[model samples]
Target: MTGSGIHLPMQSIEAQHLAELVEQFLELLRDTEIGEDAALNRLTPVVYPEDADASAEFADATSADLLDRRAADARVVQAGLVALGEGPDAPQQELSLAGSEVDPWLRTLASLRLVIASRLGIEADPSPDPDDPRLGVYEWLGYRLDLLVDAADELDGV
Candidate 1:
């Protein structure tokens, strides 16, 4: 029996529970205050620049910025999840403000979403996947990064 008290093969893990888990993970990351060096090391290259040196710098910068941004975004997503689970006024849930994966399941989802979005030039759908933490993080990160990237693109255009 799972924490939710309902079990049906693989269907036991409900979306609400998964969302709660994600919230918890985000909260931990926000609170722990992991160093920037560790955060940068964990992230692999996504879109590399033409210049090898420049690409490395880009990756480093992106990772650092993302580490902080993701933590904030995760808090928002977690709040949404909590509201969905226990109603809007359940409690004032807080996050670490640092950033960390709520579950191992979300890592691949984040990578895949970024790849697909970059390739297709499309924003990801906001659907939440409870079974995979990676997908949840990806969904949250997608919207957040989209805004930042769009803003930068606009500034560059100007």
Candidate 2:
């Protein structure tokens, strides 16, 4: 690992999966402009839940900006992911996450997990159906998020 940030050497399969997920996530963010689907709604949560008026006002004022920031963050992570991909079907090589990318990566991973969780109904039920294929994806995202947290902590000398 470099002194600047995380130096994760993910297997090609893992890296490819992550790249695909991120691309899907970026699509979700773009789709938010038309309307808020369940997954997008989960991603940008309401700050003011108690008051309907306040929540609408808040969403009107900040929802676009929040999503914009998220898209920007996703873009940062995407930039790093380009090197990880070998080709359409080829295996990816190692990846080096520079210090500037740590926060964006952390956010992007969380966003992806949230979207997957929303789709899998994981958020509604603490324990979703283990038999479900998407459950594996949800769990995998959590594992990746955990690794990013640990790496960021190490990078920060925490």
Clashing pairs in 1: 29-99, 30-96, 30-97, 30-98, 31-96, 105-134, 106-133, 106-134
All-Cα superposition RMSD per candidate: 13.8, 2.8
lDDT of 1 by residue, 53-157 (tens): 876777666755665665565555555444444533323332211122222223422533543343333434544445655555456556534543443344345
Across residues 99-118, which tens digit of lDDT does each residue of candidate 2 receive?
Answer: 88888998988888888788
Q: Any runs in candidate 1 off by more than 4 Å, and if so which?
A: 1-13, 20-44, 88-158
Which candidate leads the pack in TM-score?
Answer: 2
- Candidate 2, superposed: residue stretches over 4 Å from native: 1-3, 86-92
Clash tally for model 2: 0
CA RMSD (A), model 2: 2.8
Provide the overall lDDT of each model, using Cα atoms, as 2-decimal numbers: 0.43, 0.80
